[model samples]
Target: MKKLFIMLLTAFVFAVVNPTKSEAKVMYDGAEVVKGQTGKMTFKKDIKVYKKNPNGSFDSLVVKRNNFFKTYDIEKYDGKTFYQMGQYRVQATDLVVFKEVPIEIRSSFYNDPIYININRDNGMGSYGYYFLRYQLTFLDNGYVDHCFSDGDEGTDCDRYLGTDFKITERIEREYGMRYEISKNAEGKGVPLKESKTEKIMEKGSIVFAKGLEINGYLNVGIEGNDQEYFWVPVNLLKPVGDK
Candidate 1:
């Protein structure tokens, strides 16, 4: 009995000390968009759509066949390749016809500017600066502030300008191709290029203004500090008052 008790205690201790690592869940494949690539696909037959749960399992629902859906990226799950829709995944075997659609830039900034509220927190709603013909660079977190020092004291300083406001027009100047400034041997400021791309705005965040569409990206103006515009996926942004 004592030997058995010892073995159980050792197992418990080991399990507590080095728990089994949970499987990593990937939401997107981070695939680069090639020129003229299309995301529109038609379902071959009625298929079950799978959405990954937070606990590493999947919940499925039936989607009618012959329906069309656009996928942004590819995903690998359970050794199977799946196309990623907004929140749903369909297996590659279910798709039959692929269609090419011309990229469209639909903006209402001139008639009526759309305002949005970023629903993400904890560094998720952060944005970057897009340098034309150069690269998009992520800014440091310290440079961003949700509330400005205008003698307003509230959770988000909504009283200052309110959470919903129209994004101002874009400033017609180029953001130099550098993430930060560095001093050279002569004490002159040098621009250092950053290779890290910024994270996409979380779903449910608001898009205030949209400018141009190129290669699945939209030049958007969002609500935040640092008076400038940024580029994000056209599908990721939703107008204000949308569920």
Candidate 2:
């Protein structure tokens, strides 16, 4: 009987280890878009996203894209498994709401911007730079599927339904984050555009979602020394089109 119990314990351990197979959870937000191979997109190049204070200063420091995707002609680069579209992609709690979270700030170098900060972090919501930090949680929901593109939040900072409109929780804690924000380097804030397709992605076609959080579009500002504020969003797009 003791031996049988040990065998059952081993099975339990294995079952727990493979929880993704049993968890009845969606993996991404529905509004997010993806191009390229569609599977787990790769983040080969080192990228950075940031949060700006009302005073026009960067108040957040969120992500640093891994370099594997950049060196090779990899299709996906999201720091996880990469596969083809319609294969392993999923729709989970994507889209970010202007909610509150903790944060810290630092002076922006190069005299171009202002400050940067540490926003929220979670495996769900947004991935690397896909989180919303403290001080700025007033806008409505924005797409978060395309880790390298913008979200659906509109500009002007109006609060509305969060990205996960499906979430019925009375008080959810969704946030946004970004990575690498330096001028001497290739910043990843170039307002991403739609480039997905039932057709294949072109060799040089800029792949991304029309979400407002993409580079150059995220409405942020500089507030007090490292103070936080809700960033503005514009729209959500399909990686292939303006869905």
Local distance difference test, each candidate: 0.39, 0.26
TM-score of 2: 0.16
Among residues 3 or more apart in sequence or in different chains, the pairs in candidate 1 whose N, CA or C atoms overlap within 3 Å are: none
> Which lDDT tens digits does candidate 1 get at residues 190-225?
111111334444445444543344333455544553
Worst ten in a row by lDDT for model 1: 184-193
lDDT of 2 by residue, 43-65 (tens): 33333334446687764333234
TM-scores for every predicted model: 0.28, 0.16
Best by TM-score: 1
lDDT of 1: 0.39
| Counted clashes in each candidate structure | 0, 73
Output the worst ten-in-a-row residue range by lDDT, candidate 2.
Answer: 100-109
lDDT of candidate 2 vs native? 0.26
Root-mean-square deviation (CA) per prediction: 20.8, 21.7
